[model samples]
Target: MRSYKAKSVTSIQLPPRERRETVLTEAGHNVFNLAADDVFIDLLTDSGTGAMSDDQWAAVVRGDEAYAGSRSFKRFRETVADVMGFDRVVPTHQGRGAENVLFGALLDDGDVVLNNTHFDTTRAHVTNQGAIAADCPAETDLTTDTVGTFAGNFSTDRGWDAVEEHGQDAVSAVVLTITNNSAAGQPVSMANIRETAAFATEIDATFVIDACRFAENAQFIKQRDPEYADTPLSEIAREQLRPADAITMSGKKDALANIGGFTAVRDAALFEQCKQRAILYEGFPTYGGLAGRDLEAMATGLREAVQPPYVAERIEQVATLGDLLRDRDIPIVTPTGGHAVYIDAAALFPDIPADQYPGQRLVCELYREGGVRTVELGSFAFPGTNRPELVRLALPRRTYWHEHLEHIAETAARVRDRRDEYSGLEIVWEPPMEELRHFSAELEPVA
Candidate 1:
């Protein structure tokens, strides 16, 4: 089973930094505002932070940089088409850029979009375009105690219900985010996908897949379900893509590149409209706000990502971190997600009141104590009292090793030792009616 070694052909060491008395401040109460050197192990997110392979670097060097009809864009477009099963490729700077182009082309005011769980950007973009976003998680009987195998499934009945309630004329799309990020990185069942596709067709609604983490989702399907135990990762992924009329993808995650994304579609009209929008906002359809080399790197990375060992090892590394935290009796999202381990912040900081922002405290403390930087997925991101509170530790691909995670595990145990001591944080400044405010929301430890 082991045919090749993955040792990095490069050396790494700690970058120089000026020791600071504290990582927090009146200005930088949030971890997002922290200086890069202050964070020793940055698990803030997996997006656009992964290490590109040597082969990708080679591709980057050999890329064509023409302003129009670039050969690099052609290569990138062909690769995504072959791997993702889309005939038309419209590149964008990142996932959100793709979303902006696609949503701008497809959705209008008063249109309703359904998602299993909408991540922050997805929801913001929907409402930004004057559309309504509704979440329909798999289980109507959702409980916090037990974690289901496919917690990411979209309810088949709910999709039909949305179409019926709003009238098919008002329903724009049904989106399934692979390894649903908002609900923790859980995989959707193939059965669920097929069922949803049928519902979309019945209502004449577009089935748009948010495939940012498509490869990892496929690996989980093989590992969790016996029916696909022997299927190739890429083919299983293709099956997931089969019923989709359109897709929004982030080259930042599974593509193993620094930055780039694309919107691909089978609907010819939508394809042309998306291209028009991409040009207006992003750039020429060829570059689409990306350097030609970035597109080339994405082309190679997408191909390398599906190879068995690469993805298998990638998910395995994340599980190892989750396992470490579990062995310490720390609570986490069960069946650790493909990309990250989520800490149950509510349980971790029970002493801190919800209004005081306990999750924010945990996030800053990790940075202040162990130089570990992570992001809060609950109140800070959602700004809701009813939403589940979570601290996400998203590992970048090929960027970190076990020793780094071991240090993080030990650091988390240190934080857990004083979890009771954290009084919590309270926002002192927030933007007026901002759709997204976590980036600039100023907070202070509750006095």
Candidate 2:
């Protein structure tokens, strides 16, 4: 394997223990509220937190800043069409922006959008438009210990149950999230993608994909799916997306770019509708709320992301982290996932109840112990949804090396040693928006 070396470095410092305690208290025990300077290793999210490649930076200088019909936009559109097999592409500032535009145009009141599992922002966008966001994850998805090749597959049984209750016409679109983030970052098999597309077709609903980690998903398929073992990564990616009528992508993930995303569609009419909504909510069709330089970088990054070496290395790095934690008896999602290692918070702190926010408490302790920040995906994030309590340690693309992974594992082990000393948290204040309250909600240790 060829090692990719970093050409630039940035300095970061870990604040003292007393300072971390003070900052954690002042920030209402939320890692999101902490300043960047006070943190040592930031694992809050992989979204736009990666280190862009030198080639991507070079493309940035070559960007054409024209307001309309820019050269950068042409390259970006061409890349999407060639790689994703979608001719109609509309740029967006990020993945959620693409979701907002596509959902705004396609969905209506009382409509339903089904998925394998909807991430935080994706579900919020659907419900915000007065539509129902229904998730139909496979049974194995919830069982963190069960090892499966494609645990991210959508459950047709559950989906059919939803259809029977709501009627076929109520389902506006069936969206499949590749490498399902909400399900321990599990990968959706190519077979499942085709099955999902067929389900959408039978119900006369559009088939869409939330393809934030399309490349990572394809890499998994190549490694696990026997029929595609000899297929190239780029070809596997195209096949993975071929069943979709449209796709919403987050360039921050697989694309390896700092910013930029797009909505690509097979239908011309739907493309036009998405473009109009993009204009209303984002910006001009050419740039969509982002600079031309960002479009150029995204175009370059998209091509770079699917290369065999890059995709293999990215998945291997994540597996290494999971292995380190597992060796220490840390309860993580079995078989590991593509991008992040999900620690089973409930198992780690059996004494802490779900309603009391065990995931959030673990999140606070990880930071307080080693200045390593992560996010909780549990009752706090989902509120009344009753989702499993898991703490996600998302590793950014090419940002941290083996040493960093070791440090993260050590920090987790340290917390596990003193797990009994920790307690749960209670939400003291939160925003009015129920689905989006986790971002800014304030919490404290339960009395």
Candidate 3:
């Protein structure tokens, strides 16, 4: 491994373009170089097309006819029915939009929702209801407590008891985030899912699945479990969905070739209620607040999402990055359960205190040092911003290559070697200045 000099005192500033070599030397490649000009591998965001054919775009343009009347809505309904096997489907603009509508419609004041864990936006919506969201597994559950935090661990008697005490009426819904994001992209076992669904049934609580990464989750289940290994990807998807009453999907993550989302209900009446609310918050039921192009792409994207080989290829690429990082001992999340690798910055930068949080420190250091930007998923990955720190590296839909991963491995090893003097700054909330909104504050390191 190569070692580099650390400056005892230096201003934390972007290196001048004229000092471009210094920037590359300090941080490697620009990690956040998705500037529409860089072909440098993109693994920071979840906004890539899965190489959809031009014909699909054409179909979206033709959507005016088949999706015009109630008959068109029926045709769109058939698409959801075919993909998820749910007869009642209500499309939404994107993943969070769908979540907002779903939570707004079902959650009332003083209600509570339980999740394996939650995404940042989801927690915001739950809190927006004047309701609180709680998780059964503690922070240590993902590390050194694998058995206690296994995906199916939701089947534990204690978990069931907690839900029971909350009472079905008090508990608005039980949400299962597929490919459990916070747990190092871990997947939920089928047995656990079925068991939890059964428990939800016993309590008459609605079962909701945040299926943003369903394709990736399904592929993991198929590869790890032998009995399910031979199952067709589509069949496996349907089986996983069978336990839920409603599903919210982000077409951007895996369904649509572009940005869009859908919220589908199993019960016709529930779907109608969701739509009535949609008209107010979103748009009309027919388009579900999405543009006609989005409606068209989502319908076709849902179909392509089920193709097994396509799903497998993406999963394989992610696993490859995991292998690379682990080989370098860069402290990345092992087993690479889902599609992203979470680098444990706390372990990488042990000198940084918890209050300052290494995850936040490393994010600032990486960008200022190398111009490569990644997300701070440790505390930010969760709600409330009070938890173990993490540096999250999301493998965008089809971005990056073997060489890119190699460069990442090299860069991470270098960062790990000189983390002693890096000082991270505190988070400060600010209004988002662009279309891509961030969680909490846009943090920077103290020079």
Top candidate (lDDT): 2
Using TM-score, give the best candidate's number.
2
lDDT of each: 0.84, 0.91, 0.66
lDDT of 2 by residue, 67-137 (tens): 89999999999999888888899999999999999999999999999999889999999999999999999
Worst 10 residues of 2 by lDDT: 139-148
TM-scores of all predicted structures? 0.94, 0.99, 0.84
Off by over 4 Å in 2: 141-144
Model 1 per-residue lDDT tens digits across residues 1-447: 322446565453343332422546744578787777556788999999888887999999988888889999999989987888887989999999999999999999999999998888888899989998888777722223447888889987777777778888888888999989877787898988888899888877899999999999899899888999999899998889989999999999988889999999998999999999999999999999999999999999899888889889888888899889888877788777789888888888888877777778888877766778899888887875356778889998888777898888887888899887778788888876455777778888887
Ranking by TM-score: 2, 1, 3
TM for candidate 3 is: 0.84
Number of the candidate with higher TM-score, 1 or 3: 1
* Pick by TM-score: 2 or 3, better one: 2
Q: List the residue pairs that clash in candidate 3.
A: 31-372, 32-373, 378-390
The C-alpha local distance difference test score for the whole of candidate 3 amounts to: 0.66
In model 2, the Cα lDDT at residue 421 comes to 94
Q: Where does model 1 exceed 4 Å of error?
A: 1-21, 140-146
